[model samples]
Target: MTNASLTDAQLARSIALEAGALLQAIRARGDASGKALGDIGDREANTLIVARLREARPDDFILSEEALDDQARCAASRVWIVDPLDGTREYAEGIDDWAVHIGLAIDGRPRIGSVAVPARGAVHTTDDVHLPLPAAANPPRMVVSRSRAPEIAKTVALAMGTPMIAMGSAGAKAMAVVDGRAEIYLHDGGQYEWDNCAPAAVALASGLHASRIDGSPLVYNCADPLLPDLLICRPELAETVLAAIARAR
Candidate 1:
């Protein structure tokens, strides 16, 4: 794809906003019963977003959480990694923490990304756009899964002298840092590449630190495609957070 046609940032923002609208439509229907919300909404959102992407950028390949695993993406140097709805549980529960994530992986690294949180009426991007950074000395706040807060996360929060804020959706948690709603977002449990790619890209673009516990960078568009852990914190708190995770390990 030529750079002039659609910039990475522009594509990411477009996909994110479109998917977010789909998610909101599903939520408005109020069919949150027997996992109906998750099933119907996630599938619809995924299908619509993928279709839109294919139409918008036919030359580019895609790797999405809801689609069948495509080995073809592994060969493509530039691919779009997406999670149409990153927080099904929260969405089903009628919570506003769910988000739509769209990321572009160039050379196996998330180089451009966007996340849209409909409930919060917020859209985030990792482009040239500048969002004000939160105060550096503010007390660190750790965000973990509302349904599945791992003991390790709690332990690390205590070790870091911060409070643990229970939230839903990996993408939304990462955006909390971007919006200055929280200071840290960490998870050691299993997560797919689609789950982290867009949010990680946005965080990295916004000048935040996002990587593995050992401080390794997060890479996408891999064959295995499953990412088990992530650590996203403000730059000032990166060292301290990494040390805490190291001690816990």
Candidate 2:
């Protein structure tokens, strides 16, 4: 296929799907598990994603977890931020919460993105048909880390009396808000641009509110790329969620 003809969104989705499939195949072979499996998945998938994006849009810059950060990307207006394998721990342990994130940040904002949750048989993208999310729970349902639920997240949940759901991967947690399985995904411990760029793009496009926990815009393609926190929730709940987070801090 001639990728030059594809739009930015389509290219991102295609790349994400291909990378996700490759990861699935590697896992299915089962020659390795744990760190071995994760290593292969991360390496091969990053190679595939980087090569495809570079081939399709050579002028655009890329920021990937596995690849060395080309500091030059900070000067480019269009940058692709990627997490070849989010939730490596879950993936290593044979969990399905892992994902591949492909996001294009334009003018420092996530303008297009696609997240491939291969195990879930889903690829969420900015091009998706928007649907009305299920009615959010009254107190709201918050998605948190399976192992270390952030103290800030727990505090917000308690303040709002929200029900918490444990999950792996920042992309999956953010997508939970998009999928309507949960209304809020408040993260505080830490994260990078790749960790949430695609998820943020999808969430924002899906009509959910996405931003820093402090309610600032989620910028990307920075020189450092150390965006440590974010908040994604229903638009109506953004205010309430931000308020709770403020009080919690």
Best by TM-score: 2
State how far residue 175 of model 1 sits from its true place (Å): 0.6
Estimate every model's Cα lDDT from 0 to 1: 0.86, 0.93
Clashes per prediction?
0, 0
Q: Write the per-residue lDDT of candidate 2 for residues 135-236, one digit (tens) a residue.
A: 888879999999899999989999889999999999888888899899999888569999999999999899999999999999999888899998999999
Candidate 2 stretches greater than 4 Å from native: none
Looking at model 1, residue 109 earns an lDDT score of 91
Error of 2 at 221 (Å): 0.9
- TM-score for candidate 2: 0.98
| Ten residues in sequence with the least summed lDDT for candidate 2 | 131-140
> Cα-based RMSD of the predictions, in order?
2.2, 0.8
Q: Tell how far residue 233 is off in model 2, in angstroms.
A: 0.3
Clashes of 1: 0
Which residue pairs clash within candidate 1? none
